[model samples]
Target: MSAIKDDAKIAVSVVVHACGRIDLLDRCLDALVRQQFHPRRYDIIVVDDEPNHNTLHLVAGWRTRTLDRGPRLSYVANPGPGGPPAALNRGWRVARAPIVAFTRDDVVPEPGWLAAGLAACDDRTEVVCGRVQTLIAPHPADAQPGAHALEAADFTSASCFLRKPVLERLGGFDERFDIRGSDADMYFRLLEHGIAIAQAPVALALHPVGPAPWGQSLLRVRHEEFDALLYKKHPALYRQKVEPSPAWDNYVVAGVLLLALVSALLGMDIMAALAFGAWLLLTARRCAHSLRGAAHTPSHVAEMVVTSALLPLLTVFWRLAGAVRYRVRFA
Candidate 1:
């Protein structure tokens, strides 16, 4: 790849959404300083969602220390501690470049990430989506790959480059997605508008899956609410791209448990035993396949196994709630 000329007109503004994880923000900012692209050719904007002044103070102090050779850095405070979508919209509003890139505080972009993303952009490209690879560190002692061990997603806000005009025309991210699914919603809108999205395989970002509480899966069950809304807004596209098959897994899991409970209540011991056995067998098989390379240690594997068993039940329950709230049957 050729080096970007000093006089080149292409400059990118990177917007990072940081919500109280100052350490991760520090690492992300430090990584940006090492990018192969010229420091003057790119700018970094960190949007802090923390309501308190601590995050702003931390960034202010860190900004003074980074004036030597790093890209220009700045921070924007959210109106309140809302969510990433709101923070992102605020950051991009003041962006001064033709290319507006998005990433998260927890993500660290590769040194060539910016260069590759810009190189992938042209008159025909409306959006440039980089690859996101999940880093699963099962144990503290294990060596982490500087790059991704496995690629997790083809596109995400974790790393992306979009033309400033298109973003402005679309009026930035939809705040309706207060927390999750906003990234997907943005892309769906762009596609609907006949915009051409390109892929930059070399523009990589590492997404580390941090350790979490056992109830984390239950919290994620809330995605069903967003899914219901997403489907309601764009039924054909959502069904075509997001979920081609019906939510049979949820129904099947719930059906087995319901059958078992009914049989037990009716004093049909043999039927109850068969229904319970079937549910266990199905859950075990699915868990084993899904956790193949994701779980690295015994503890990690155990956590995943237990979470998998509970996730389906939680999914069905929340799906019902979402259907009622949205007044649309997901099935």
Candidate 2:
């Protein structure tokens, strides 16, 4: 890491959190390099969660290429505990500017993104939330088996700007909610502290939804563990903003299937048949809901059926696991 010169006059430090997706990172960097903001007033920092030769080389190449013409580009390796929050912390802590802008490697900002974000940051504003447009598959049939769009929330870290001093005062992000929910937690904390958050509608970024393999939704169930932590930390805000009620449908589905299994083991053939029929009905409903606007290919339909039948059980298990681990009365 080279030292930032004393007279560089950097105003905004754009922190991009990346994993090993060099292809996406390459596009993100390309967009940043062409920002409408003054090139010398802002710098780009790429924080790699899992830094390897490919990421290092990509950042190094961008740094060399943009050294004279554009904002200075640098790479930082995330220290310990891997997650977006940790990577963001690493990026801003080493930033040369007082204002920090956050975005992901998969997102491509418009040319005026930085300029608009900076414009919204007045003396009274401690944070600025930018707009993000998500691009998904052109057609349902072309969508991948487990494809999903990224959530373009009101105050996601993917397109927000924050004052470095305010971040330091708030202790940055809570690393315990490692997989997710940290961004909303931070936003709620800012409100608690009476810090002003402004919205910049003109600062736009494009997040392209990508393909995923089969069973991707099942793999995402682990994110529920952090929901317990978020709720424990901010019950009122979590209820108001996140979820007002538990997923009652998931519980119903799981309970019906369990009842069917127990009745069969007890040799109650009639009761087992009824419970199994109910379970099938509920599972079919879920599968139909999932396939509403999704790909309707035969394989996609099969995937939805199989995953929908098992998702309720998995979701309930993870929710309970989170509640137990966090010692919260969440469900």
The model with the greatest lDDT is 2
**After superposition, candidate 1 runs with Cα above 4 Å error:** 1-10, 138-152, 178-180, 210-212, 266-270, 287-305
Would you list the C-alpha lDDT of every candidate in the order shown? Answer: 0.78, 0.86
Q: What's the CA error at residue 7 for candidate 1, in Å? A: 16
Clashing pairs in 2: none
Model 2, 128-198: lDDT tens per residue? 99988877675443234322323446588889999999999998988887535888889889888999999
Cand. 1 TM to true fold? 0.83
| Model 1 steric clash total | 0
Error of 1 at 37 (Å): 2.5
The runs of at least 3 residues in candidate 2 whose Cα sits more than 4 Å from the true structure, single-residue gaps closed, are: 1-8, 140-152
